[model samples]
Target: MKAQGIEVLLVFDPANMNYLTGYDGWSFYVPQLIVVALAEPEPLWIGRGIDLNGARETTYVEDANLYAYSDRYVHHDHRHPMDFVAHILRERELDNARIGLDMDSYYFSARGYEVLRRQMPHASFIDVTRLVSGLRSIKSPQELEYMRQAGQIMQRVMKVALGNVEPGIRQCDAVGEIYRAQMRGTQAYGGDYPAIAPMLPTGRGTSTPHLTWTDKPFVREEACILELAAARYHYHCPMARTVFMGDPPKRLVDAAMIVADGVQAALDAVKPGATCEAIEAAWRSVTAPRGIVKESRIGYSMGLNYPPDWGEHTMSLRPGDRSVLEPGMTFHLIPGIWMDDWGVEISESFVVTADGYELLAPFPRKLFVKP
Candidate 1:
């Protein structure tokens, strides 16, 4: 803030709030935020009165710094939570301060911004959407450990998903098992709810990504894609794989091999000084020779996030990114090929090491073919 000349910072992203104050709750559905003033000793937590206890329990914030509005402000046509927020700013003598706002966060609604802008017309708001997220690009030792644990849980989750998906099994039922394994986790520890739901795109649905499952039964010779993740204390490790119910087509097997090899080459290129685009270029070097033309990015920075996305919204492993890889940076390299009628996704999560890279999700890199 001192460098950016921001006297105040309004944090609206739930993940950012969690990262800052350890304030974890389901209160992000309504309006809630953390106010950081340069002159203040500690950040202030503001939200609904109903969630006040939740903030007190989860956050290390002092009771005096915790502020809450009445229930009447929730969902009311005329009464908005930002009005209360603006009032707090006035009380702090920061109504005219230069504030930084996370304008692009999923939780920062237009209505909330409009209300704040109108209520505090004297204050100048700057867009610092990527400021906090950029700081999260590198992981600490504890953060890396949590993500490693999440990867272990993710391996089990993928195993359950692969085992349940076979000829004649309902897609929805298979997804149910996947969800069970994701939450049940390993006996040593438990799993937290991931940011995204279990995506079980089966058969023709595999042609596109992000499709949820239905009650339809799996058929022979069709491909099924499982894109899932497991979280430990909100740290995530996402993995993806393709499954063939019966005798796999030659094209599918060959494509899977290409993807696996390409991902390996990409991981091999990861190091402290390498650029993000270098990894994508390594994968493209292998795939392009095999007539594979993928326009989408191969991977992205990911960790410590909430619903709607687990991606860090920072560096991306694709052409023109040019962001230099660091030792503690982590990424999910999911190179999925979507054809007109079928698709295959083979992915891996890894952390950049001083020498190279270490795979987080320790799973087989081949397509599973069930006879």
Candidate 2:
């Protein structure tokens, strides 16, 4: 925040709220707010009375302010949630201060922005989404532990999924089986999004990277690509593997091998001084000449959330993105080879280290063939 000249960073989006407060509640539907006053002693959390206790217990924030709204009654017309936010800022004498707002982080309704603008007309609202994103790119020890647990859960789920792969099984059936296996007998299993349905794309459907599960039955010699996420500790790690039903075609096997090699190349390129674009380029070098056009980034930062604060949504395998690789940075290195008939996707979760990178998920990169 100091690097960006942001003295105060206020977050209201559910993901950012969770990142700041560590309070993962359904108050996302309500007016749950988190204010990080860097200059102050500690952060302030505001939420409904129902979520107060949970916020106090779960969140790292020590000082919490609770608000109770009437169920069947009408209160002061000026007691709306946005009004409360504005009141808090005013009470802190931050009306004219340069306040940073995460434009991409929070999904404020037009009414909410209008209320804020009207209330603090003198305050300078600057977009510090990138600043917050940069901060989130580097994971803390606790965040890394959560992500490691997420990777472990993904490995378990992948094992269950690969074991169930067989000829004549419907794609949806396999998906349902994986979800059941991952979600059973665990409380913190499916983090924020409880159910992450696996994508079992058979044959030509594997050509498309993000193929939806279909009713098509697995056929002999057809490639079955499974993509799934295991949600644990509110963090998710996406794992994908391509397998064949019968004796695999040599071309498919070779292509899958190339994709796996590309992932290794990308991981090998990860170090403290490497740029994001360069790391992606290294992965492409391993597969591009082998008739594979790299469609997307090789990887991106991961954290206590899936599609976390720092994601590959905007910054991608393009020029001018020189995000320096740093220790504690986690990324999903998904390198694939898209062929005319079939495709191969080998993805793994990795954490950047001082010298190199460490694979978080311990799943096999080899293509699994089920008889």
Candidate 3:
């Protein structure tokens, strides 16, 4: 904030709110803010009166720094929680200070921004998008440990998904088994809810990513894509694999080999001095010759997050992203191809080591052909 000349930062992203103050709750349905100021030693947590105690229990913030608005402000037409936030800013003499807002964050709703902007017209608001998230890109020792545990859970989760997806099985039933594996986890520690639900795109649905399940049963000779994650303490480790119910077509077999090779080439290109785009170039070199031209990025930085997404939104493996690679940075290298009526996906979540990279999930990086 000192470098950006932002005197006050209104942190609305729940992951960021957790990163700064260790405040975690499902109260983000309404308005909430972590009022961070240069003058104050402790950041203030402002939210609904009902969640005040939750913040006190989950966060290290002092009682004096925790403020809550009455029930009237929640979903009320006459008032908003930002009004209460503005009053607090006035009390701290920060009403006129330069403020920073995460404009692109999913949690920072437009109505909330409009209310805060209208309430504090004197303050200069800067769009500091990805500022806090960038800080969270590199994993700390403890954060890496949590992610490793999440990866261990992911190994079991993926095995369950691969085993459950077979001929004559309902897509919903397969996902049910997956959910049980995700929640029951290993005998050691249980799993937390992933930011994204299990993406079980089957047959034609496989041509497009991000589709959930249906009651339809799997047919022989059709393909299914299993994209799922396992989380531990809010830290997520996601993985994807393709499954074939019967004899695989030669076209898909060749494509799967190309994807596997491209993924490995990208991983082999990782080093301390390499850029994000260079890693993408390595994958492109392998795919361009095979007539695969993917417009979407192959990989992205990911870690601690909430519902809707698990990516860090900081950096990505694509053309022109010149972000330098550094040790301790984790990424999901999901290089997939979706054609007109068929698709194949194979991915790996790995962390950058000092010399190279290490795969998080100890699973096979190949398409599973269930005969």
Candidate 4:
């Protein structure tokens, strides 16, 4: 908070709270937050009384710093938990201070903000949506280790997904195997639930992204794309690949090789002092020449996260994004090309190094074909 000149920071993003205080639980469904003031050494965690035990168990802070409201505030029409938070801030004389709130955060509800605003009318609220997020962009050595473990889990999960997808096999059956592998994870480590579910889009659905699986059985001469992630200690590594059940189409086959080459070229461009825009340019140079123009940003920063998405919402590997690359920064390079008929996505999760980028997974960088 001092580095950003923020006097008091109200962290409503669960990921930010987790990063700051090691407080982790399924309490984001409620109005919970971590309050940080420059003068205080430890952050204050507040939430429902029922979840107070979770905060104590997961966090390393002193018990005195934790506060809990009554269960009456859960869905109370007249009461809000922020009202109690404002009372604490007032006690600390922060009601008139410059307070930073994660206004754009998913966990920070519109009603929560309004209640806090009314409760602390004299306080000046600053839009510090990415304040803590910027600090989390770079991974520490321990954080990288967790991500590597997650990558190992993904390798096994992908293997199950690749093996079970076949003709006459229901999409849900293959997804079931993927789920089982995710739960079982690697031999050395167990898996945590990913931020997003597995995306198994086949045939026409592959033309569009973000579609989930169906009970429909696979057929001959069709394409299926698997985009899955594995989590270890809430650190994520997302990997995706497209597969063909039978003799794949010549056009898709050719596109697959081109996409593979483009991804490698982009990976090679990852070095310290390089710009994010330059990396996207390297990938586009290969595909644009072939008349393939992808409108979406190629990649984004990735790290510890909760459900709904795994992206860090910090930097994008695309034009207009001049965020300079630094060592320890991690990104998910999603070099996907979606045409009117079909789409191909072969991606990687990598960490930026001094010399180049290191891929999190040891999986092959080519499309998978099962005959």
* All models, RMSD in angstroms: 0.9, 3.9, 1.0, 1.2
Q: In candidate 1, what are the lDDT values of residues 277-337, reduced to their tens digit?
A: 9999999999999988799999999999999899999898999999999988999999999
Error of 4 at 336 (Å): 1.6
Q: For candidate 3, lDDT tens digit of each residue in 38-140?
A: 9999899999999999998999999999999999998888688888888899899998999999999887778777888898889999999999999999999
TM-score pick, better of 2 and 3: 3
lDDT string, candidate 2, 106-176, tens digits: 34555666778888898878777655555677778877777777777777778878877777777677777
Report lDDT (Cα) of residue 171, candidate 2: 69
What residue runs in model 4 are displaced by over 4 Å at the alpha carbon?
none
Instruction: List the candidate 2 regions with Cα displacement exceeding 4 Å.
Output: 62-64, 67-80, 184-197, 211-221, 247-251, 306-319, 337-342
lDDT of every model, 2 decimals: 0.92, 0.70, 0.92, 0.90
What is the descending lDDT order? 1, 3, 4, 2
Native-to-model Cα distance after best TM-score fit, residue 102 in candidate 3, in Å: 0.4
Q: Positional deviation of 242 in candidate 3, in angstroms? A: 0.3
Model 3: colliding residue pairs: none
TM-score of each: 0.98, 0.83, 0.98, 0.97
Q: In model 4, how large is the Cα lDDT of residue 307?
A: 83
